[model samples]
Target chain A: MLAFKLAFKNIFGAGYRTILNIAVLSFAFVTIIFYNGVIDGWNQQARRDTIEWEIGQGQLWHPSYDPLDYFSYQDAHGPIPEGMREEVSAGRLTPILIAQASAFPQGRMQGVLLKGIPPGQAILKIPTHELEAQDGQVPALIGKRMAQSIKMKEDDRLLLRWRDKNGAFDALEVTIAGVFDCNVPTIDGGQVWLPLAQLQEMLGMPGEATLLVAGEGFTPTGNTGWAFKDHDYLLADLNKIIQSKKGGSGVIYGLLLIIALLAIFDTQVLAIFRRQKEIGTYIALGMTRWQVVGIFTVEGAAYSILAILLGALYGGPLLWYLGKVGWAMPSGSQDMGISIAEKIYPVYGAGLIITTVLLVVVSATIVSFLPARKIARLNPTDALKGKIQ
Target chain B: MESIIQIKGLTKQFPVGAGKFTALRDISLEFHRGEFTGFVGPSGSGKTTLLNIIGSLDTPTEGEVTVLGRSIAHLTHKQSAQLRNQHLGFIFQTYNLFPVYTVYENVEFALLLQRLPTAERRKAVLDALEWVGLTDKMDSKPAQLSGGEGQRVAIARAMVKRPAILLADEPTANLDSKNSHHILQTMKQLNEELQTTFLFATHDEKVMGYLRRIISLEDGRVVKDEEIIMDKITEG
Candidate 1:
């Protein structure tokens, strides 16, 4: 406690210098954490979008569903194999069908991708924006781009046009109950979701969803098309897909780590140079090299704590506001019906924030030793003579 | 008399621009317990260097230095620091009281090395300040005091640890006549009351007059070592 108090007093003894050092360190901390937060935010958004569209928490597929797109559902011919139903009921499985279809809604005509889903089971696989209460049934949310192209709104009736096995235009008029804009350009512009029952009735295809993703609840035991549950593996797969879609977060983290180290190093060196005389006095007064080292290292730890607290205090709300009212997209893409929610989400996880703070403390502590070593080895006489380097 | 400090054949040299400059050379001296002694020399005559060696602030290149029966010149770096802390007190020409500390805290710092309890430390520190007649200024900083008051605070800080020897380098160099007299009287009284050995290096004639013994040096050699009765003591 005495060492800590003395170290703290020595640091703040020179008011201007201490404040200057803290300012430089705080700016450096902010820069590193900001970049770190951005990478985390981008990865989170990418992962959420990927889980919603490309893959899910886990996937269950037919036995014949191999790597080739053409080899789907050829092996397991039937009504989702009975056992997978148990997995879905236990919140471990989600069913999806990916099929191509044509959409003719008044003046808009285009071929679109259709995703058939069981909403209750789908929620377990891909997270959705939890909607508010409506009348009897939950609203069927359409992509913003799809809604804009057809000039549809809540309760507007539009025909879902597709081809049936009879080689005839099979059309069903469905109400556009809600609009969802998940900002992945491909998904928002071209896809629509329908209930599994409705999709089966319209396309005359029954008993099989194109893909089924199962989460951690079951272990596959032989030739039953059952796979073991591994949450780590599932997260890794999701992370890989996310990285491919958005970008590598590691590069940003690496750059910020280097920058933070350099900043702390510079601040500590300057502090040591400024306090060489005080260090000499301390040494002359019977403080050992190890005690002096501990003192300065603790000072570095204090600075790390202060900078992280200030950064978090300032950074959290700024990111939240950015996520809330995002920027407007460019005018040329105005026809795509871009919403504010999708463009600027700066969401972050607790683990990522904690890890970043820990890294800052470790880096600062390490950097402080460079100066502490110089101080510990200082000869009191030479140091008093002002020959400290 | 028991020797508080002994220096035999001591020499110090510094390297400067492809040449060797000797600061002290083949000096021998002994400081006895409960004595007031002064070292007088010209600039560059190495009074400060000799004092530093005695105070464990500097090491001799070619001699033996024993303080309180311990060979301080041969001690390790940490040992020398402990020697200074346990046995020696230092008063600088500028008083060297920590400017940021109040008078009480400045005195308390010397006692911090003792690891005394808080109540004992406070009592001893306040008592030391009272001995220097600066008890009223205990809460004031060094800058708030006059030159003599600041040096008194420095003296209090030095004596607070109850060190066996007090070493002062140019102790009166920065004082006016009145403050100089006050500091010398304080040191003399403390010498009589505490029986602590006081060693000083100075160019001030007034400082030398207060001493019972004088060791004068020239070119790092002790040219004169003599005892003289202090006239001010007889008058007081």
Candidate 2:
């Protein structure tokens, strides 16, 4: 306990050197916390956006359905079972028909997915009310990305070609009824939404859909020829993406830790090297070599106390403002191939702050102790003479 | 009088360049309680080496050194430190005061190591400071003190715990002639009043004038050991 008091006194006694070390360390503390908070916030926002836009509570897929195999579009679909009809009408289940098609807009051919959703249902976030056919023309809703790629505005017309369920080619003019903005690239890039019945009739598959998306409070009680997909199973691909992203972030975390620790290590080394006379003085004044080591270690570790206080003094307002206003993601975030929202509001949990404090304090103590242990080997008499060796 | 320190066939060696260089050779010495003695010598004459051996800061390299009846040669590092903490004090040529600590804290540090209670420790520190005439400078750090004042603070620090013996190595080397005499007088007064043994390693003539006994060393061997009687000891 007395060693702690002496150590505290010594740290403050160091004057400007103590201030410089604490300032550098506090910046590191705030920065590490901020980066971790931002990454977690991004992960949460992506998950929420995915749930609202693409996948609902869960999904049910036909036994043969494989989204990666475009050729399976023909075999992956089956007629909606009798059991799902009532639930589908009541909006607890949403049926989507998927087919491969190509559009020639102003002499340019682009492959796209033709997704058929019910016009009156509100199970998803898409604006499906505009999917009603206008004067026998197939009304289609395209994303802003698709609209930019094809340079097609609302009320414009494009020719779409597709193969029917009976191995027949059919083509029709699809009129762009709306161009919508969304963060989920799956729904917004090279994909068009049209009415379910019109698409089923056009493809000669009158009562079939590729998969069924379950809505909130939906319970699957065994439907024939359909396998129930739980939330974890449906979001497995997204989880894998997020996990890899976390792995990448670990590299960055490691770099930040090394930079901070290096600064601390350098300061400790210099202090020990410069203060041999002090070490000798302490020994002469009745301190054991180990006690001298402890004084130095505590002096080094004491930086964390000031670092944390300063971090909170400045970081509290900055983090609170960030939590409210959120971080604005860069313009081309969607091109990075992860579901990042336009803006992500960082969430700083109590667990994050506590863990960071423990990590920094422990690390500082260890780093401090290692260098000060060198004092144990010093010759006290020679050290008293200010001998370097 | 009980012997406070005993040395038998004591020798210290330093490994220089290729072989060992002997600093002290086959020296036998004993010091009684309440003695004011000076080991007088020029540089490299083994005076400081003898003091370090008796203070438990260095090993004998050849023979036994017993301080306050404990064999320093067989003492573990911790035991050696305990002996020094409880029974020995040291004043250095450079004062060696902690630059960051005020005079009061520096003096209080000795009592602190003994785990004395706060009130007693305060009294002890204030008493030590008063003895050195630095009561008004209790809050002043070492940097603010002159050479004489700094040495006085060091004397207060060394004597605060009232150790049985004090080891001083060239304690007056950095002080001017006037300050040197002043410190010597203070130490002589403390030695008489407290009945504390004082051992010095120095060649300063002013320090030699205040000594009741002088052991002269030359080339790693004691050449003269004598007691001097004078009608009047110089107050300086």
Query: Which number leads on TM-score?
Result: 2
Strongest candidate by lDDT: 2
- Cα displacement (angstroms), candidate 2, residue A31, comes to 1.6
- What's each prediction's TM-score? 0.79, 0.94
List candidate 2 stretches off by more than 4 Å: A130-138, A221-223, B230-236
lDDT of 1 by residue, B78-136 (tens): 78778877878888786766666789988898567668899999999989988999889
lDDT of 2 by residue, A59-102 (tens): 77888888778888878788898898888988998999999988
Fnat of candidate 1:
0.41
| lDDT at position B3, candidate 1 | 77
| Count of steric clashes across candidates, in order | 4, 0
True contacts kept of 2: 0.51
Q: Compose the digit string of candidate 2's lDDT tens values, residues B1-236.
A: 99979999988899999999999989998999999999998899999989888888888899889999999899887888888889999999988888788999989987888899999999999999999999999999999999999999999999999999999999999999999988998999999999999999999988988888899999899999988675436543
TM-score of model 1 (CA atoms): 0.79
Which candidate has the highest DockQ of all? 2
